[model samples]
Target: MQGKALPGFRDFYPEELALRNHIFAVWRSVARRYGFEEYDGPPLEPLEIYTQKSGEEIVEQLYAFEDKGGRKVALRPEMTPTLARMVGERAQALKKPIRWFAIPQLFRYERQQRGRLREHFQLNMDVIGEAGPAADAEVMAAALDIMRAFGLGPAEVRLRISDRRVVVAKLRHSHHVAADELVPVLAALDKWERAPADSERLLTDALRADRARVRPVLEFMSGLRDGAAELRESAAAEPLNECVQRLGAMGLGPFVEVDFTIVRGLAYYTGIVFELFDQGRSLRAICGGGRYDDLIKAIAGVDLPCVGFGMGDVVLGELLKDRAKQPEAPAQLDAFLVAVSGEDVEPVLKLAHELRDQGVAVEYGLRHAAIRKQLELAAARGAPRAVIVGPDERAASEVVVRDLNAGTEEKVPVARLLNGFFR
Candidate 1:
């Protein structure tokens, strides 16, 4: 039978793995610098956990099934729900404002495209037990720090910030939309940038379809963007005024701007939503998060106001590639030992190991090949120095070192070779 692989799945070869590791290392370093302790959970969890928090709508987007024991299970599509569950499991013992970060492999059953994969890695950062604007600021700062660490400046990305509370309150106060219909309209707003005309049509249709129910919500969004002058003319401007003040106090007012349009796709968010986007808005969100103050209490029966953000590795990688700043090929080894004759192999191997033990990345020529071939291989591997141990050199208890880049050669006593390299 002919064999074929899945369309959206991919395999990582050695070179690709090296690059991925490099990117992950940078993420780890940045997370550590911000004092975020790393934590992890199982890749598989009960399906009901996600359904409970994200709603069954998420089930259509997840890879879920019933196990042999008939227990519904799912591969995690994101980490926040799992984090919430874990914190709930130990709510009484944990400290406040728990700072944690994790890089987990998340799976989603979605159409694969550039920067969107069925399987990908995401860096999640969360601050629990605090609901103040400062907690929100810190999370936003960390997200910005990550982008800067990747050499991205404000011009490369912008954090579009909004308050879900403001969204709801404005909708109810100005447009009088019912609570039940809020979520679907918000989901549509989240897609506005990608499908502007369609989103407008959907919003308009939703409002006309249920004017009494949806008009207030539409009016609220309109007021948020353009009706602000008119709102100043009205008396119910406290919420919008407070939102602006809080954003300023958080010191994120410049990096952030009110995007009445930013409705994060997830249903769990309760307040203060924001998303990071490329300057050109040509790609998906690089990161996004909002307040889920009631999630911990609802899930674990312990109340904690938590805010966090998830930065997916895939989109960031694409951004780096587009900027022509992807990590370069890793440095080659310092030395390569070439045994000119089969008899010299043992000594070459011994010397190679000794150099490695002395903190040098060294490799020994293993194939049975001529001296010229071995030297060619060393050059191709980008070895800065080549160590040639021939029968004559062995008899004299000496070795020859050739500086590949400089084309310089010297003979040194075998025992002094280590000292010479170290020097």
Candidate 2:
């Protein structure tokens, strides 16, 4: 038997890391385009942080343990807790509606699935002071544009959105559901899509009322599926309607929709919630977030309105791979320097150094090797061009540059080579 990475962990070799880096680059670029500055926090935080936000039972899914100092700590499973803490500490000093982003490697002790890993990097972008529907549109737009940057179109992914608070209000006002029963009923709605029977069961159990009383609630839930017009007219759904219009005005209307089923599973989401899923429904959510208006206040005693989303690299990378949107790993070097003979080594080293200092990626064999072997090595390393330094060229202060792929050679003076080839 051979040793391997832990069951849910991953080992990213060079080629694999290229894809990860590409995702990060696109994440940062898209985030910056939205004026969201990057930020970070420690990977480890007090275990109470997680417990406080999600309750003690959440420890079962967290990589939690006590340290030598007897302080319980855990790898952060999500960025919102840390963001809440950080924002709370400086809420008074910082500007309103803080626009910040972080690419954090989150860890969780959970069963492995296609897109769910033990550890993965996630892009967290949050607006921490705005409560308007426009802020929701902005965060949603950032998530959508990142997918767009990877060449994914609206056809590949769609943002299914819902507002738990608004829906709860509508249910309470129209269906006569009590405020005490909202959470369980909302949970039912969250699962209503895949398990309508289970949802009905849960809702009935929570309500303890007859099926006649629950009929309106179920109709309300059903209306969310394809009832954009009717629901949009309701005052309870005005914020969501405004958000839809905002996205439409921005031309991202085609990428998003209204679906009350997206309660986000987490209890913190208080306003418009959404999850981006593949059009084919073949994977877990590629991204998910929504308004957590009071979470900051509850966690850190700072009541900053916040809207954000977390897009994990694991599911996204899988989605990109499936769509063939991932870029191929970059080739090794811009040029490889090969010495024709022992006497030509010094000039080759000098030119290689100079070229490197000039910002060109250049590589050469460390020990003396045959010219043929050197060129072979260059090709093996995927160098596009090879600079052959022979006695004749060295004597003439020139070098022969061979295009590895084109199989053509050209001679240029060492002084002019930089300007000609690199330019």
In model 2, which runs have C-alpha deviations exceeding 4 angstroms? Answer: 418-420
Cα lDDT computed for each candidate against the true fold: 0.78, 0.89
Give the TM-scores of the predictions, in the order they appear.
0.87, 0.95
TM-score of 1: 0.87
Q: Per-residue lDDT tens digits of candidate 2, residues 1-423?
A: 689999889999987899999999999999999998999999999999889867899999999999999999999999888988888999899998799999999999999988998999999999989999899989999999998999998999999888876777778888888888888888888889889999999989888967887888888887787776676677878889889899999999999878877787656888899999999989999999999898999999977889999999999999999999989778769999999999888888888888888889999988889888998999999999999999899789898989999999999888898765686
Instruction: Report backbone clashes per prediction.
Output: 1, 1
Best by lDDT: 2
- Once fitted onto the true fold, the runs of candidate 1 whose alpha carbons sit more than 4 angstroms away are 1-5, 208-255, 420-423
The number of the candidate with the highest TM-score is: 2
* lDDT tens digits, residue span 152-205, model 1: 877888887766665666666756656776766776566565686676667766
Model 2 RMSD, rounded to 1 decimal: 1.7
